[model samples]
Target: MKQYEYKFSFLPEAINDCEKVSDLETTCEVKGKYPCPCCCYNTFPVPKEDAIAYICPVCFWENDVFTSSDDEPSDENRGMTLNEGRRNYKILGACSQDMLIHVREPKSDEFPK
Candidate 1:
């Protein structure tokens, strides 16, 4: 029963393909503009995904950012609209900031657990 969740994101000074990480172990990886993970102050990665309704007037909390094949975007990570035109649905954050590596959960469950 290990479930520690913290949502609030950013980290995109320049994203082409998309993929950023920071769980903070030793520190030093957060490129350009910082302070986001609920740090309050916002807006860094913007090229406009065509008004996706980003509502978060400091923790009103209604933005998923992106990257969710499955892991709960909460509200069950919703669905529909794949962003076929591109921009792949914003949010390139958290690829691995802490906990280094290890994932087996329900996908089959058998690895070094």
Candidate 2:
């Protein structure tokens, strides 16, 4: 318990400031010579057609969807295009906020390795 240096928790304010961010909302097709997040190869195909995510063949970094054709690509949306944004995906938009990853200090007497 003492070994733990810090813990992070979601702030209520974050809800007001938090924007939708999710892989389902941000994955985009990387056509042509574009670097793959995994192998940095420019020829990676769209990994998940349904999810629109990118998986590098060389490095094989699957589930690394983070590309958008829109002018604004951000972490919240995992880099999705404007048309395919959260607003476009109702189910995803609802769960997208869960990705915010709020944390809390250990309340139990457990040491982390």
- Pick by TM-score: which candidate is best? 2
How does residue 68 of candidate 1 score in lDDT?
A: 46
Query: Which segments of model 2 are wrong by more than 4 Å?
Result: 1-32, 45-51, 66-113
**Candidate 1 lDDT, 1-113, residue by residue in tens:** 99999655675465589556666544432121221222123331332232143432222222344634333333411332223111222232212222113211111221112
CA RMSD, predictions in order? 22.1, 20.7
lDDT of 2 at 13: 36
TM-score of each: 0.16, 0.23
For model 1, the run of ten residues with the poorest summed lDDT:
103-112
lDDT for each of the candidates?
A: 0.29, 0.38
* Model 1: lDDT to the true structure: 0.29
CA-RMSD of model 1: 22.1
Look at candidate 1 and tell me the lDDT of residue 47: 22
- Number of clashing residue pairs in every model? 2, 3
